[model samples]
Target chain A: MAGERSSMSEKLRVLVVDDEALVADFIADLVEEAGHEVIGIAATREKALEYLERSAIDLAILDIRLKGRLNGIDLAQATRAREIPHMFITGSGDPSTREAAEATGPLAILQKPFSQERLVSVLSQMAQRDHSLN
Target chain B: MRILFVDDDPDTRALAIRAVTHEFPNATIREAMDLTSLDEVLQERPPEILVTDFDLRWTDGIKIFDRVKAANPLCCTVMFTGTGNEELAVRALKHGFDDYVVKGSKQLRRLAITVRSAYERNNRLRELGESRDLVLKELYHRLHNNLQLVISLLRMTEKTLGHESDRQQIADLGRRIQALSALQEEFYRSEDFRRVNFSSFLERLARNLLETSGGRIELTAELNLVELPVDLAVPLGLIANEILNATLKHASPDDRPGHLSMRLEQIAETLILRISGDGAGSGEDPDTAKTGLGMRLIQRLATQIEGEVSLEHHAAGAAWQVSVPL
Candidate 1:
C-alpha cells in the first residue's frame, strides 16, 4: 500500500489543527508516517486559517474542542467553504459535538489514542477520495 | 363475570349452566348450541370466560377457543372433554386453552371451580406478562445506553493514546464495542429483543462500515430474510465488522476504485455468509490472505456459532466465506 501510495503524482499535503501542542505534533508525525506531508500544525483557529491561506493544503485534521473562541468544528466549516476535505480528531464523544462535527461531512473522525494503523488507514483512504475528487 | 357456555347436547349445556350459576350468583351466562349461535353470541358480547364442549356440532371447541382468544386475548377458556378425549384436552391446554374439565356425572361438578380459577390465573398471568415486558424493555434501554458509554470512553481513549501498538489494540477493541453497540441499537429499534431480523441487521451493519470507509468503496449486499436468536446475532455482527475492517484495510488499492460485497443465505440447516472485496489478493497466495488477526477472529467467531470460515482468492478479488449452524 505504501509503495502504491508513493507512486501517486504527489504526496497529500495535510494540515493539522489542534489546541494541544503535543497532540498537534503527534498528528503531524502520524500524517508524515502515512506518507503525507504536514504543511503546518496550528494550535489556534487564527494560525490554522493563516496556514490555509499561505499553503495549498489538500486535507485537514481538526480537533473539535480548541483553545480559542473558534474550535475545530468552526475550522471544519471554514474548510468546507474552501472546498478542502477534512477529518476530525476529538477527545470528547458528546452527541452535540459529534453532530456538529458530522455536519461538516468529514472524511473520518479519529478518537483520541487512535492507533497508528487506523490513522494511516484513514489518511490513505481520505487521500484516495481526495485524489478521485481532484 | 359474563360467561359463554357452548355445548351441542342440551343435557350437558344444562349441567354447565347449573354449575356456573352455583359458583357465581351474579354471573350472566349465555348459551350457544352450535357454531352459528356461538358466533352470534360472540359478536353480541365477547365473554370473559368461554366454557365449551370439545365436540361441538359444526366445529370443535378448539376452533371456538381460538376465535375467542384471537378476538380477545384476555378471555379465559376451558374445554370440556369426554373420557376418550383426554388427549385432545391436553393438546388444547398446550395450545393456550386455560384448562380442561373431564365430562362425567361426578367430574362435571368441578367445571365451575375450574372456570373461576382459570379466569383468575389468566388475569394474573396477563399482569405478569405486561410487567415482564416493561422490565425487559427497561433493562434493554439501560444496556444500550451503557454500551454507548463504553464506546464513547473507548473513542476518547483512542484519541489520546500514544503508542502505535497500544492504539491499534484500542482501535480493535473499539470496533468490537461499536459492533456490540450497533446490536443494542438494533434491539432498541426492534420489539422483540430475543430475535434479530438478520437481513435488516446486516444491512445496517454494512451501511455503517461504508460510512466510515471514506466513500472509497461501494458496498452491495444480497441478504436473505432470516431471523436469528439474539445470542447468535451479536457474534455474527462482530465477525462481519472484523471482516469489513480487514477489507477496508487491505483490499483497497491506491489507484483503482474498490468494491465490497456481502451475501448471506440459508442453505439447508446452515447459514452461509460471503464477504468479498477488490484488494491485494490477485496472484497472491490465499493462505497468506488468511494470516491475520482479522481472519483469526473470524475463525473464532465461526467456531462460537458452530461454523467454519474459509478464505479464498478469485480472479476479481479476495473473499471470506463463513458457514454456521442456523
Candidate 2:
C-alpha cells in the first residue's frame, strides 16, 4: 500500500506568492526540486488573483505581507472562496497576525527562512492527499 | 532642558519665565504670546517642558498640551492662568497637565517647583524607556545574527557530505534550530525576558506540526494557562517536539490517518504533560526504542528539569508522559 501510494502521488501545480522576487523564485525552485510544478509566481495580491483566475493551481505558498493594498491574508480569503488549498510562509511572528492567518485555515504557516525539509514535507503531504482523493 | 511658555498676557509670561529661570538657571526659555509664536517655537524645537495658560486668546491649555504631546509625548506640561477655577484645574489635570496654578504672586514659586519635579520624573522615565529599548534591540540583533550563523554553518557542513542520510540529518538539525528560533520569538513577546507563555508555545508547535499533515492527523490539545521561565520552557518544548514528531511519524502509516492528543495542566504546583497517538504500536518501529537519539533526548531533557518521564505501549497506540514540579 505504501508503494502504491508513493507511485500514485502526482506533482502539484503550485503558486508561489511573495513581495520579494528573490524569495519567490527561491520558493519556486524548492517546489520544482520537490517534484512539484510552479504554475505561477506572483509579487502582489492582485497578481496572485490574476494567476488564480487564469490557471488551475493544486496549492499556493503565500507570504503574508504582499506588495499591494491587499495582502496574503486577503488572498487566502480569495483562495478559500475558490476552494483552493493554500499555506502561508511569513516573516511576521506577530500573535494577532498569526491568529488571523490561522483563521483562514491554511495547510500550514511556515516562518521565513524555514528549512527546505519542512517545505518538502508539506508538499509531499499535499501530493499524497491529492493521490488519495483521486 | 527646553521650556516653552504660552500666555497671552505679556506680564504673566515675563513673571513665569523669570521664576522658571531662577529654578532652572541652565534652562532655555521660549515665550509664545499667540498661535503664530507657538507654532514658530514648536517648529524650532519641541519643548521638554511647556507652561501654558488655561485661557489663551487663540487656543486653550488643553489644545496646547495635545500639540506639545503630539510633538514630544514626554513633554511635561503645567497650566498657569488667572482665569483658572477648580473645574478648569481638574480639566487641565485630566488632560495630562503636570500642574495647574492660579495666577497669584504667591503661586509663581509653587509653579516653578512643580515644573521642576515633573521634569525630573519625566527624565527618569525617559531614561528607563531608552534602557529597555536598547536591551531589546541588542537581544534581537544577537538572536538574528546567531541564527543566520548557525544556518550558514549547517549549509557549509551539508555541502561536504556525500551521503543522503547525512544530508537528512543536517536537515533535521536545521529543523531543530528553527524550533529554537520560534521559542526565542515567544520569549521576545513575553513581558519579561526570563519567562514565556508555554501554552501559546505549545499551540504554535501543534499548528506547525499537524496543520501540514494534510488531514492525516487530528490534533486535540487541552492546554491550560502555563507560564514557564526560559530555562525550563526551552527543554520541555524540545522534549514535547521530539515526542510529538515521533508520534506523528509513526501514527500515519501507508496513508492511514491517526489521532494525536496533548494535555498540559498544572496540578498542585506540578506540571504534567501528556501526549498520545493512536497509531501503530511501538514494537513496529525499532527507531522509537530506548536506544534512539529521540528517546535519549526526551530522557535527558526531562532530567534537566528534574522531571520524570514514562512511556506506555498499548494495543492501539503509545502514550508518553512527563511531570515536573513547578
Q: Residue-wise lDDT of candidate 1 within B137-172, one digit each (tens)?
A: 556534543453565466568679889878877777
Candidate 2: segments with Cα more than 4 A from true spot: A1-29, A36-110, A113-134, B1-117, B120-168, B282-288
* TM-score against truth, every candidate: 0.61, 0.58
Candidate with top TM-score is: 1
The residue-level lDDT of candidate 2 at B124 comes to: 91
Q: Which residue pairs show backbone clashes in model 2?
A: none
Tell me the spans in candidate 1 whose CA falls farther than 4 Å from its real position.
A1-134, B9-15, B81-84, B105-108, B162-171, B184-197, B214-216, B226-234, B250-257, B268-270, B279-292, B303-306, B313-316
Q: What shift in Å separates residue A77 of candidate 1 from its native position after superposition?
A: 30
True contacts kept of each: 0.00, 0.07
- Give DockQ for candidates 1 onward, in order: 0.03, 0.09
